[model samples]
Target chain A: MLFRRIYQFLIVYCIGLTCLLAIKKILVLSDYVIPGIPLILDTFGQVFRGYFFDVLNTLSVTILGQIISIIMAFAVGILGRKSSWAGSFVKVMAYNIQAYPIVALAPIIFILLGDGFISRLLIASMICYFPLLLSVLGIMASPVKDIEHFYIATGRMRWQLEVKIRAFENLSKLTTVIAGSATLAMAGTIVAEFIAANAGIGYSIRIALYQSDLARILAALFMIGIVISVYQGILETLGAQLKTKWSAPKEGELL
Target chain B: MHLECDGLKYTYPGAKAAVIDNLCFTMTAPGFNAVFGPSGVGKTSLAKLLVSRGNRQESCISTFDIDTILYSYNQERLPNWSSIGSHLNKICPIGKETLKKELIEIFKLKPLLAARFSQLSMGQQNRVNLIRYLLQEFDLLILDESLANVDEALRETIILAIKTLFPGKMFLYISHNLMEVAKFCREILILGESTKQRKNFMVRGRDYTQGYTLDKKAFDATMLEIMNAF
Candidate 1:
């Protein structure tokens, strides 16, 4: 029994080692070069000392834009659901917003806000807001009938439905959508910073690319990928929980 | 309080004749009143008229008398501003908490309060649908073949539960089953037997007006035989 256990452990250990090596190789290819001890130490020092505040500044704009845009989308969606005129106007506006690449929008933001966090936030919101609205509105509109009758029968006002029923029903999808849009918003921030700001990782990446600091460039990519992955994971978990909470399974049908 | 459909009439918009012609009826309040008839008659149409709908082929007609009733409605619209939940609450007047509780316990709609309207099983959704109708106050309840969606077991269960909860409401329950109607509602209106002489009859307890359509010759023979016996 002890020998068999040892054999199983060894096999597990070998598989784990192989997978780690494979991941390490992929990371390096994707610009996460793990060099010898001295080089690793130097890279860590630079990353550790890298302006953590700058990252915070970048995320602040992203969070703000995410919140504002989502709220606006919902507001307009409510209006559109009620009136064809409002809906048409909003649809046209959404299309117009879609026409301009956000790279152009970033310059406008910088010109308007003069290199502050507000400028980046505006750019992020521009990218983040529309997608958030589109996803959530579709989600909200489709599943609305039964809930409407429910609220109507209960005599709940529009406010109660919005706050209690619609919001609760949409909690999962909205969170996941926001989470995904946040990554794109983050990507937009990087470009926007590359164009205007002096601090964020985007600016550093630009500098690294210009000066052939491939090591630092790879490191930054690694960081971005890791952050985005973590966010996506979180969003996925939230969506799964919400789906389970809110939905019923099909019954008596052949699987 | 009774639900009375005064001159309830409806037709598919483009159709030549009305599906329900000059349909006027009264259901005693808080009693099970089955709308008994064969298929393709105006039994379902009568219910649809009472419930109120949107379009010609698909609409419900609710003729509310504001003088007798207290109502708040923006008439010239298609439920645009109302979310599903809000609309439900508006018509029902019982809180969402009550719906949620009943949906969970009695209907066994536990853990599915937030699901999409389309996602539920037909029977489960049927239960939910029944809940929607019961959510609001209407002295008159009109059901148009609503029980067809559920299985026999669920049908019986739902029937009993509705009977228990809505003891004070008027029901215009439409079903094809005569026996089921006898079990629930002794009062029934069987539509579509005569073109010239439409018959009106009453059924009490297990007794049913199992009447057959008679031609002029058959009627003459039957009446002449009755006259001879007298």
Candidate 2:
């Protein structure tokens, strides 16, 4: 369980470290005449400071967007379960949304919501919505014949069945789904910022590219990695804790 | 309380013929009954109809007399024994503690309560499933092949426990095992093809013998004769 929790962080760390090393090698080989090592250190310090704030802005947007998306998905999921037609419609819409590429949709969202934080949030939420919605719906629909029978026999209301039984039964699966969607949420935020945003890691990278500042661009990339790694680490830790608390005890363990 | 279904007809969607055609039967309280049939004889369909008045998707052609019937089948949707117990408590809040303790002891479910449904052996799951429904109060309890996976000794113990603990409740024990059915159930409702080419028939307990215990070999022979004649 501990290994599973840290595996994603390890992967992100390796990727970030590799990118930083590549950037360092590039700085060493660059034709630009740096008179002393102090000059190079000063340049690196400035890039790191800028990357930190830009990545923080991006992280804030992604986290807020994901929370909104999860809540919306849950609302729709509950409504769908209550009504078969609504459920089918939501499923079809989710499928279409998932299939539609985020890159293609970002510009349209930017125009509609305007090139602001709202547009970035919208894009991130859209990217995160489908997976969370599908996971909730799938868990609800998965056949638990005995539990269904119990619900029907007891004359439980639709909402009670959804909230009390289905939700509790699928808590572990839902946690995993939310944690898994963190990366996609980050991706969506970055894409939104890249297309039209005034401040974010993606925006910083864009400015760095315009100015031909490879070191600053590298810093932005590495910071993006750090932000995602932190978000995933928190999610994974929460998921593990939930599993330990709510999961059925092992087979041999006495009740 | 009693369970009665009349003029029941069920045909699966997109099927050519009816699976259960014009089936009718009645089971009264204070009696254990067996629904005996061969494989693919719509015993399960009859059990579903008897318990829940047909699943949500199927059109309801049958008329049911009873409102609350506790049903258990071999295919479990239980996550774990603990949840199952908790659900039973939630459903039947009255006498929850006593019933849970009684059922746990009778079914020997204490050790298996913490294990997930999938982690337990099939026999363990079957016992757990039976105990889950037995916890609830209903006018009629339908056991649809619920004990098929259990061993002979455990099956006898469960049947005895049900008879001893829940004497007032009506039980419809559906199984292909005629001997086990004859052992516990005084009434037998055999669903088979009729002489007039009808797909279903209902036979009463008195037709064989109006008694709880039966001669095992003789009962098997009689059941075979009835099946062959059908």
Candidate 3:
């Protein structure tokens, strides 16, 4: 699975590069407008090591932001699982918060927290939180009626057991959602850096954009694509393993 | 245990006519009773109302002296992530270990205990579902075609085992199978073709347990009576 993801990404990157070169040839564009193969390679040779570290820095914030979003999503999902007034209120409040554009909110966040790690982290989490919250809420709110009826009949339907049953029934769906959310987390972190942060690959891309350095921007895109692909691949592999271990427990691990 | 229904009436929401209209029955002892009817005759709806302690102001389906009335059906599914053995262990009360073991053996579910619910066949799944309910603490259990998918021979074995093991408790066995109900249940209530008929009647069954098997003639007679009533 990991190898497939990497090769698939490589195919897309090659096609995209081919398109840009074609466009540059047709328009007779200069190296600054659409860098040639030699110029892009030169830029990669000059800044590959620095961009690698910068991408790693962005990745750290992405991981932390994803963790925060997952925790927040689960908390809200559980709270809003039922149809009670409080559950509905929590759900409505989450929707309202998600409706506000993060880009518009980023300036205020930077003003309060400044262009540092905390602001980047908060922005990334906010950008990644809403979609995940919606998915969790959807899974949690729907009851697995077939399994739940037995518990209800026996008078053993506690809140914790109810939550576990729902979660266990939808483990595969939840795993897929979590793995898919990695892309959003990476995008969130990069967007944060692009807007205001002073560090990470996004900052490098901003500087490249200002200098009209297409080669540098292309190099940064390459780094971001490679790292995000590897990270998402790892997450998907882990999700598959978890599903296997959960569905087919060992002999003594029955309960 | 005594189950008495006086002026039992139920109509589903957004329906044109009542499913169960002015129905009534009385069972005075703890035994394997049944409600036998054709398809779409509101057997499941009646079971739900019985378990829910139906609207007292509209109808009185009273379970006098019975605390917990559990309704188990053929379509009920167990949690699939865990094995059948784990489900039984989780649901079995503290003092019912011996009973659980016996039920597992009787239902012939020991070999399949290590398997997940989704891995089992329909018959096996129903057996496992019934076993978990049997392990629970309930005064009255309504088996609404709970063994529908099982073969005739195994269903007989399970029914006999349940009757033998839980002697003093009450079981309301609902099924479309006439022979089993006539042979096993002490009293069988047969519902009419439609609610408009208002022709529900009760017939005494042979009440066969593990050791007692009535003559073939008497069994056939009771079966005919139940069929004719319906």
Candidate 3 lDDT by residue in tens digits, B1-230: 79988878887899988898778899888989999988877788888888888445555787777988899988888877788898899889999999999999989999998888878889999999999898888889999889988999999999999988888889999998888899999988888867335568789999998878579999989988877764
**lDDT, residue A202, model 1:** 80
Q: Write the per-residue lDDT of candidate 1 for residues B163-214, one digit (tens) a residue.
A: 7776666666777765466555646665663242552233432312223232
Chain A (candidate 3) TM-score to true chain A: 0.95
Model 3 in CAPRI terms: which quality? Answer: medium
- The TM-scores, one per candidate, come to 0.61, 0.78, 0.94
Residue lDDT tens for model 3, A34-122: 99999999999999999999999999999999999999999989999999999899889888887888767888998898898998899
Sort by TM-score, top down from the best: 3, 2, 1
Instruction: For candidate 1, write residues A115-222 as lDDT tens digits.
Output: 756677677777877776676556555435444543443455475454445556666667767767878788777887778877677877788778766556655665
Q: What TM-score does chain A of each model score against the native chain A?
A: 0.69, 0.80, 0.95
- Candidate 1 lDDT at B16 equals 81
Ranking of all candidate structures by their lDDT, best first: 3, 2, 1
The residue ranges of model 3 lying beyond 4 angstroms of the native Cα positions read: A249-255, B54-57, B195-199
Best by DockQ: 3
Model 1, A54: alpha-carbon shift in Å?
4.8
- Cα lDDT of candidate 3 equals 0.88
Of the two candidates 1 and 2, the one with more favorable TM-score, higher being better, is 2
Q: Candidate 2 residues A1-255, lDDT tens each?
A: 445445665677568656655765778754242223354356658887777888889889989999999999888777665447777888788777778776688888877878889998998888998888888877765645556775566565466554656766777778778987888888888888888888788887778778776556555665676667667778878876766556555434533
